[model samples]
Target: MRTRGSLFRILGLCLLAGALVAGTLLPVVALAGVVTNEASETVESLSAELADEPPPLVTTITDRNGDPVATLYDQYRIPTAAEEISDAMKWALISVEDRRFYEHHGVDWKGTVRAALNNTSGGDTQGASTLTQQYVKNYLINVIYRNDKAGQQRAQETSITRKLAEARIAIQLETTMSKDEILVGYLNVVEFSRQVYGVGAAARSYFGTTPDKLTVAQGALLAGMANNPSIYDPWSHPERALERRDFVIDKMVENRKLSEEDAERVKDEPLGVLPDGPDKPAANCVGAGPENGFFCQYVEDYLLEHGMKKDDLYTGGYTIRTTMDPVANHAAKESAEQQVDKTEENVANTLSLVKPGKDRHEVVALAANRDYGPDAAAGQTEFALPSAISNVTGTGSSYKVFTAAAAMERGVAGIHDTVQSPSRHVSDVFVGGGEQCPTVARGTRAYCVTNASEGGSGSMTLQTALQTSPNTAFVILEEQAGMRAVLDMANRLGMRKTMASNAATGGAPDPDAESAEARQSQLEFFGPSENSPGKGSFTLGVSPTSGLELANVAATILSGGVWCPPTPIGEITDRDGKPRPLQEEQCEQAVPEGLANTLAVGMSKDDLPGGTAHAAAQGVGWNRPMIGKTGTTQHNGSAAFVGGTPQLAGAAMVFRPDRPYGGLVDGGPGNVRATDGDSGNMFGGKTPARTWFGAVSKILEGQEVLPLPAADPRYERVN
Candidate 1:
């Protein structure tokens, strides 16, 4: 590796080098730390180990189409062969960095003497380090960082003792390795900028081209910047970079490497920096920027949960191909950033889309707007990630389908069953059915229930209840179906408690683990501290989940009840280029076809005025037959829409205003506006519904527009 201003860094090389060449160790023996005989033996030993080093490789990540999307690197560098580097670049570096590079053995005695005299004479101590010595110093530094940080600090010490050890090593390095090997090694370890190490990476970052393509003028500019990458930044300080470039060209003329005419001509040329865009993209998924950053994290989490090793991801040199559709991914990003106003704190949008099927379901898009990092939020560790995963507090009315389906699956109710309801519904059938479900309020036992105001008071059929998503209708249905039945249906469909660990949630899910009572509280015996939900509130979506899972649920219903848990990775290859085995396909028919179809029909009524997510169907503009549901929780804490066609399904959710119980957006937040200016606050039908609509519409643009399955005769409204 190369070091800028290295003479001061190598502590005491001059005295030892002079003494060794003079055939006497007495003058420098004490400062050198070893006797001449011992030093000679040590140098010989290091010579044999230099031949075993290997070139480092970088890992790649691509989309399902085999298009490169990002790279994961431990060193953020690419290794280049000595033969491939351009002569212009090679000469330019040699001309500016080490004039007597070819003439020197390990160290340049003449230049060394001249530097010592200059320092003794009180002139600024000039750099006398030959290219070989610098390579040794940089090598020592790199090796030390691998295991001993304290050694690195000592290696950088500007003391006589440190320099003697470096000189001794350079002596060994020069004997076993050829001059070209030393040059290549130095180029590979040089730090050109922050997290950017090596001439190869620097060339690509600044010029958008390989080292072999650099012109003489371009080569000089890059070489000049090596000493001070920050100060000579062409992007930020063009004038200073231009001045250094010209100075290097002038130095070449003085050294007679270039004729006066040639140097003058080169000096007048422009900096010729890479324009418009960067050749080197971000180092990994986090660097993919705000548009796809969230999904990149999703892909990472998926791979880790599967079989890929975490250590292998950043350094194992493997390639991973994921099933992310560019079209839908971009659509979701636009909907989050432009379509939705996410200016306030804790307000973010996450959208996930799935391809319909009974077997492996391809996840199309899992995108969010905000860029994420360790410090993404002011007081929270994460915001966008939680939203994409839908691991939040409540899902609201969007959860009505699970309760409705569970009742039908168990024969407690039919799509047309006229379940008795009321303007206000209480869930405490366990304690008292006639009064409001008692919940503690202001330190006293209180009874409570309220309708969405949109659902007028009455006994409602399953079809009407689903279309309107009324709190009362869902509560009545959940009570009739038995709490166990509703809880069983939700668990079977793959909803997990928000904070459960990944290992616990993944693999085959257990639908019956939580008895209906377990859904309300951690305790087996119901008590006041239970949160006492029972089955009635299950329809209200009290649990936390993710957009990808929810979208997969919509795809499940569209596929005639078959469910395929969302899978991100299509294939992965080891460093050896062989495909590695991944988890087996997880596919299940979680719901009965008849019940699933009945529920799908209610969502397919988007063409009707009361269909909660009608705008989503219209957004596609294809007139394709599709189905979905809208959800808005209490306090408007969260808004979500899960919509689907036979071929495509997606879910979008928005959390707003950042507080324990801040205002919510059912139709639309009064301040938030749509494409046409108007307050959006309803149910999941408004903003999030529109986002789900926009993404699915674009995702299914060219695919076949299949109609929903023919409804069963039993699906007609029941009295």
Candidate 2:
């Protein structure tokens, strides 16, 4: 009475059932029958292709104290082992999805025959997939074909080939893995809702609990969602979800896994989910909050730049422990914001700190007054203002430290050696003929430089020049030390990014199509040729510079001339808890240790009387022995302060971020200009120095005070 199509469908199902049965018992001989041979081959081929690929999982990023900073993931999943799942959850899943899960060799032949007969007789569509078979199906769609639309479609299609493939893989899995293992794998791989995968993530998302802590009702609810997460989503369709949940409980009772009395009681309970629904992990760096977001982004970028694949960071389930000190970072953020309101339109304040060591220079904090987010109109930005070289501007006289180190290294001048601090000096060797250096002398143009204050007009010891930061004194010292030496020293002592090609100008210069700005950048930083005499303004810190680089320069001196890359990562581990090696730049002695020690001493008076930062230091009640320097740019466009104790080195910068050429002035809140101006007064000793002191004092509070290394006599006087 059946049609030919129906007869063929029934025949095929019967033959598959027979082959599955025979393969488990009679083995080779049973599958040799002509009708079952093709089915047998398909099963064999699919079993070989079945691989236990790990699912995409969440990657957690934490601070130095092991507190979570952020979490990243492709699919929000946290895989749990069989033992980590509660018995109630396991039983509920088995009861509703597959009652005979323990007894099945994988393909329940009787169920297959029943489904075949019913479908051929024009009844509703039915599936005979066992738990292992469902696991294989979900694995194929979510893992193997995750990125392939066509493959995922084929895996989910209601075709005989797909079902047979699932059956074969399921049978193979049963032969290899225990029932508990297969069941847990299914639970871990299945999707509970959009962007939520596995019971581990599901428990937290739905009920704000863990897998092992699920109650009977919670277990039944989660188990019901595996059938069709979208249709049974508790947040979207509460009534249907509750109905499905109760149905699952009833099934548990029928399967004898739960008592009828318990089922009735649980069915009357409300869907005890979090009022706000799913509590997903924080998304990327912004989730780290404004206080730590900048440091979080730096950590993310540092890892990616150092050979970690983007996919690996999102899905590798890595536990990245960074060097961000919560105390230091909080202090830095509060200090920066306190110095300059985050909503300030024209001016920006930023700070960076590094813990100095001969073997490691851990970046403790990187913070900006601007809130770290995407809402730029609200004065929030995700730009790497504290560390990126592109965000750097003229750091004023902070560059003098490099010139001083170069002079000492070349035996031209020592810390105690006398240098002339003329009010104005015209260079004989270096030429000047640009907007930056337009002062001409005689018929030919000469590079003329002047002191910032009238008091810097007489001869003084190199130590006095460091404290007062006289422009002409360090400029004259730069020439004596040779331009190349100073430039080299800057690069060696943590100005690596600044000395390289301008990242904002599109990397290395191209003579054919280079812009005027790019050409000027090259000339100012690198000069026309390595052999050419350097710019006279070099010692005056006329070039663009980074805050973090300035802090590391101080760190290098504090670490006895050992310059280690400012690293944010403290440790990294894989999902299995194996330590992963980080490719960090090695530390090297950038200058003689004795010279560095003596230079630290020479620079130590900046926070005392007669020094630029003395007022700021005294205002903060700072009495600790520390090395410090303050710098103000030529046009007062930017100001910076760098200082350090034996434990920490840090730098602060206040700049016109919107208009780099526009000058800053006092008389506004926090002693800063509300808007940019043509030319006005703002010094590193004011807002920048105070910001530095504010953060450093809080960071070093309660810690033992440590003394700096003694000044080396070799570099204390001219030899």
TM-scores across all candidates? 0.72, 0.86
Q: Model 1 — TM-score against the truth?
A: 0.72
Q: Which stretches of candidate 2 lie over 4 Å from their true place?
A: 1-52, 110-126, 144-151, 258-265, 374-379, 432-445, 501-525, 530-534, 666-674
Q: Please tell me which predicted candidate would have the highest lDDT against the true structure.
A: 2
Itemize residue pairs with steric clashes in candidate 2.
none
Top of the candidates by TM-score: 2
What digit string (tens of lDDT, one per residue) describes model 1 on residues 168-205? 65655565566776777678666665556667776787
The global Cα lDDT (0 to 1) of model 2 is 0.80
lDDT of 1 at 148: 56
lDDT of 2 by residue, 560-639 (tens): 99999999998998776779898888899998899989999999999999999998888879989999999988667788
